[model samples]
Target: MINPLGRLLDENNYIVSDGAMATELEKRGVDTNSALWSAEALIKNPEAVIAVHRSYFEAGAAIATTDSYQATPQAFVEAGFTKAQGAQFITQSVQLAQAARDEYLANLPREERLAKGGALLIAGSVGPYGAYLADGSEYRGDYTLTDAQYRDFHRERMQLLADAGVDLFAFETMPNAAEVKALCGLLTDEFPGMTAWLSFSVGASSTALCDGTPLDAVATMANDCDQITAVGINCTAEENVTATLHTLTPLTAKPIIVYPNNGDIYNPIDKSWQANPNARSFAALAPEWRAAGASIIGGCCRSTPADIAGMATALAAQN
Candidate 1:
């Protein structure tokens, strides 16, 4: 079989899947918010990461992301590790995904495979520089970093993924177009052969990104970036996606990928994120998104393996 992700984009069609959240997964054992847990968990429980990846693939995900989103120097500080110590964690994240892919492919039926055989694509996920601000405030006023500084930090982590043979580098959940543009240029300049996938969080109806850049502007940046293969949204409101999708389809020629959060904003008081839209929602919407020109479909926050399985069934039926 052709690469599932490559085929999905090549045909300008939607292929359903799920994106795993390391925060939520780590929460099961250690309070996800705790500092020591991240360091300990990164070393002690590669299985947990592997388990999540296996679950997504078994549930029918065409792609699985590495657990490297939180492997930054600042995150290491929060996790009780020195900046220098983060390298091992970053390398391990890639290794964890590779293990999951190997195990998944091995378990496939020994016979009846296609001529090209099954190849699972591993996407290395990179998130915002800082953890979601505790209060979700804008980073502009409180802190500012030169483009070079930002590139330096991101490049260190990107190199780990590239060296470990990641199938793609996903700049995911970015709230600003400028950040994405800089990171894209930095990566493309460094790793010219690797595929880049850019995803934004739409804060509202009018903005391409949460920071309020025009949707066309995001499209233009994604297009101009040498290695960008796809662009779309993740971590936006479900209600926000419909209009955003409509707006995005006409402005950009690239394949659109959508993975809105399953639950709305988390309410710290009750510690619950409500409005559970399951796989059925994904099943129902995948076609509409495809009709609107989305080439990939998946889940973001609060999405589990079952959600991906549901999407897979939906995609198979539609195809």
Candidate 2:
């Protein structure tokens, strides 16, 4: 059967699912602080991760990314592992994703498999490195590493994701052109068959990434990578996505995927994340996004399964 991710690469207007973040985990009683070092929970609570995947699938997600975004070498380092020790942590993270994929496949029905063509896709999520440039131009918020150091950090993580056998390599929340270029090249060289998808964060300029890289530059870089099948923006204000769609629509022929965050960031002081975009509002934007040439849709930070379900229904109605 053709892989679902491959099918997404071939088709237009696809719906990929986004995983729940710390907010959802908090609802599940996982303290945000503890989850940082809780690698064992991925295995011990496999059900939690699988349930989230299944939720998106039921919500009409044609693709599901693995819960491996924070499994980076730098993330491990921050959680108290040495550089060498961090390598093992990253490798183990990929293995967790592989296990999740295997279980997801086992749970699917063989009779419907032919029609679905193994509709499930395990996407390995690569986020920004633990560093930044002057003037807040880092892909990640850590703001401690330089561009060259970030490249090396991503190289090691890309190798781990490649070794994990994920069907696709997705770079999410990239703030700069340099790191995005390095990641796309690294994955293409190491995993020839794996597809690449990218999502850049909206910055102060609204169109430029946090690193001051323009949307067109990001799209151009992503398209130049032979393995990149899609490129778009994520992890920004919801309204910004609509603008981004317009900015990116005319730039390239690659399919676009978007998963914007709720309008406001969640700060303990504001507690404003508790008051933000609902599923209906997010799903309601699907048609607008699709018309603007965004073929793939999903949600990002602070978005839940219900939000994904709303999007699925909206897309189905359009089709």
Candidate 3:
């Protein structure tokens, strides 16, 4: 059973997903300091959110992850939105991405717009529970929550996103195997038609998850789940790219997805973001990433549209 994403890889060798939702939003003057992150734009500035997606599309992002990574009902309710409103906001996250795709397609030459293959896709983002806590615990993954508890925590938003209609799930920045296991189970049991891509954040050691679990063991867990269509790393420092890819590419037969951040560091505890002066050159590294077997690549935190466009242009030039 070939995943659709697999077909895209076969055709193009690599496809670009969008770069940094919150970081891009902040560039447009949206305040991302709240627990909601870019999810806030889904309510007060949906059109602004849509515009960002359009920017990425114009810049060559083939997939746009929704602006709902931090948009759980609990978070919204805690921020004073009602449960129903929270659900609508989640659904609207997909809507905004779709709107961007449609608008982008509409403007292309008819032949380009009507191309039978490689159309844009929307990935409903499912941020880990620790993301809601906003305490950087997502990078620690030492929570005592049971598997069922984790599943319970993710259920509502997952269902709403599925109902809203997305091409796949982007379980972004997961730090442990447990959350991956829990979400994979629920996808199998609940959203029968849905498949997901799981991207883990590498920990202090470049070869391990933030929880210190070896990528090999985690890759094994992900490989056993039929619901997961792809597996790789994201939101990790650019310096970790080579080791992370070396550890992962051999471990999974699935397509590799690697979207590393600029070497910037974020402290969820103090909500401070300091620049990593040592950040690697993202554009110069794309060829190596492709050579190393990353079939899907893009930028995460601090990666701009120009950065993604540069990668896309580079791939085009190679052909």
Candidate 4:
């Protein structure tokens, strides 16, 4: 099967992905303070979830990532859902995104829709096991699990997403090398015909992953995996992006995807975001990030539709 994302990049040079789902949901008056984070909207306010995805597409995003980042069975069970119910919710996440994509396209004129790039794709978001913890361990990468354990935790959701018809998988915000390896292996061994992008959660230093693994080391591992179509960083500070891209560009022939946070620091303790005086706008940084070699660009935590619009405008100016 032809990879639509690859085709789009071949035609357009860069692909614009959507911004943070959780951030958008919060703006829609949904409560996301629970362990499920944005997944809470899946159960409580699914229409709101659809609205968020549509807003991003309207803002010029060519890809819409699902709200399944924290929708794992373990998390749902801990939050008082049965495993089967959790599975349904995971499937629902994909459907919600598809609904948004369909609705967005229906209103657009046929010519405008065709001109909006290629088909708008839905990336099934497979967040790290740390996201299941909901305690900020994703940033620290302080957890450990055997390869079997990691695959077991992820398999059900991957299957659900595939069955629900996602365009690709997004193994995003990953911090642990072992888990990354497990996921890559699982994708190859089980989910044939699927493609994915692996984006890391890096620490303050751009040279290292959140787990302290050298960026070059993990990036090289991902680049070697045939099933992974792109490799780079996400949910990290915007300041770390260009440097992280510089480290990654030489390591992989795959496209580099970077969607850093909105230049804000997250206090995982209170689960609140604090503004950084030094944070720059995505419009201002888009040219620099593109110049540094990112072929897929968007926003992460605390990023809004406006931020994506700015990045899209900035990238459009490049051609």
Candidate 5:
């Protein structure tokens, strides 16, 4: 049987996943400054949320990652919601993405899907524990949780989304090796019946994680975890992706998925992004990243639908 991620790659020369979620929402006039980020949109403007997913699919993203990146119950309760409410909100992310996919397909002609391998997929996003701190640590890899602590923090949400029926889980934007090891265990034992992918974030260099763990060493760490359907990078600089891929592609047989942030730089102290004026060039660079061995390609922070649409056009033209 084709592995889930393998099926996605087999269906096309390269699978184009959706672009930025939180930043895209901001462009549509949603204020994403709070700790909740895009998860805030789940409660305030769900149609706005569905619209983002639909826009990605219309622009040719075959995989629509859910807006649950920062939807942990612990964070929700910290923001004053009850445990049950947080769980419901987390589950809603899956439902909204599924609804968007159905709505998009209903208006499409059968031929486009017949040409591709299938309709769009929904990857339930699971952000790192640092995301819950809202201290900008997710990018810096400053987490200090134990293995059991990390697994406890993620298990409930993983179970919630898996039971909610997302096609796959995206353990996206992880920073440390310890958390990756713990998450791989959660996938194997806690959610043994589920499927997911693990992705790490890095700094300017490709040789090590943001926290200085050697990049390929982490991939080697999970070489035996069959449940991790794929492994790669996300929320990383566009410049660093290919170099990191060069380091990672040899460590594991799993497909390499790279969805980099626009060239803009995030300054944690200022809580501002020094915008990349050259982001328009991202589309032109997509092909090179694919050639570098990124089987799953997409955009990350600071990427808009227009950016993804342009990326879609570029990638399809190359094919």
Candidate 6:
């Protein structure tokens, strides 16, 4: 299959990715209080998942990231689901995104569809093992696993995503270098036809990953991998994004993709998000991130379709 993302980047300097999935679902009245998070919608309210994806598309996003970030087989098993049921839910995540993309494009005017690149891509969200822990380990990167073990944990979900027909993978919020290396190996060796963009979750310092590995080192590691189509940061603070992009641009020629949180700090203990007074709007920050070398920009946690609309407008002004 042709790489639609690469082609879109070739035609346009920037692409707008979708905003937060779970938070958007919450706005639609889905309960995400459990560890399953947005994946819970797959079983109880699948239409709501489609609505969130369509909302991003209507907000000017060209990529619809699937709601499979925390929908791993292990997570389902822990929730008392059979392994087969876990796989079904994972596949349903992609199907839901596809439904939204197809429905949105079909109803759009021909001129508008052409203006938006004529095609919307689905990125299967492959969040880190830390996300499955649901204890904020994704931000801490406190866990360790052998490369083989890491591969075992990720393989089933990735295969499900691929078989379900995602255009690419979004390895977002990755914090561990060992796990990333394992993923790269898995892609090259097992899924050579597939491609993905690896985005990291960094600490406040912004120069290193949450695992304490230097950003340049891990960025270089991912850049060296042929299957990694883009490299940058996501689910990080807005303040750290520009500096992190500056850190990454000089290291790799690959496209830089960034989708930061809406500047709300997460309290892992109580599982709540508190407002950050300093958080700036995406309308004001999107241009700066583009200037800093981000080719793809959007929001992460706490970011809504309104925020993505701001980014789309801000980025359009660049031309």
lDDT of each: 0.68, 0.65, 0.85, 0.91, 0.85, 0.91
- Give the total clashing residue pairs for model 5: 0
Which portions of model 3 miss their true places by more than 4 Å?
A: 116-118
Candidate 5, 106: how far from true, in Å?
0.6
Q: What does candidate 2 score on TM?
A: 0.82
lDDT (C-alpha) at residue 167 in model 5: 80
Error of 4 at 58 (Å): 0.3
Q: In model 5, where do residues sit more than 4 Å from their true spots?
A: 113-117
**Which pairs of residues have clashing backbones in candidate 2?**
131-145
Candidate 1 TM-score versus the reference: 0.86
lDDT: the better of candidates 2 and 3: 3
Over all chains combined, what TM-score does candidate 4 have?
Answer: 0.97
Candidate 5, 256-296: lDDT as tens digits: 88888888988866568997776546688888888888878
> Compared with the true structure, what per-residue lDDT tens digits does model 4 show for residues 1-319?
4576788897888988999989889888999998999999999999999999999999999999999999998899999999899999999999999999989988999898777635699999999999999899899899999999999999999999999999999999999988998999999899988989999999888788888998778877787778799898999999998888888888888899999999989998789988899899999998898899999999999999999998899889886
How well does model 2 score by local distance difference test?
0.65
Task: Summarize candidate 6's per-residue lDDT along 1-319 as a digit string, tens digits.
Answer: 3566688898889999999999988888999998998899998899999999999999999999999999999999999999999999999999999999888988889897676545688999999999999999999888999999999999999999999999999998999988889999998889989999999989897788899998888877798888899898998889889888888889898999999999999887778989999889999999999999999898999999999998999899886
User: What is the per-residue lDDT of model 1 for residues 1-319, given as tens digits with 9 covering 90 to 100?
Assistant: 1134666556534555556454447555744454322334566677777877877877777677777765665667665777767777887888887787777767878662242144457888787664334333222213346777768868888888888878888788777666777788897678777787788866766355667678888788888875787888876655567788888878777778888766556553334566654433666666666676677888887766776777678777778
| lDDT tens digits, residue span 153-204, model 2 | 7777777766766667778877767777777766666666667788887764
Per-residue accuracy of model 3 over 18-63 as CA lDDT, tens digit each: 8888887887888888888889898777888889899999998899
Model 1 residue pairs with clashes: none
> Candidate 5 clashing pairs?
none
Runs off by more than 4 Å, candidate 2? 1-6, 9-13, 34-46, 81-89, 95-109, 130-147, 188-191, 268-274, 277-280
- Candidate 3 residue 100 C-alpha distance from true site, Å: 0.6
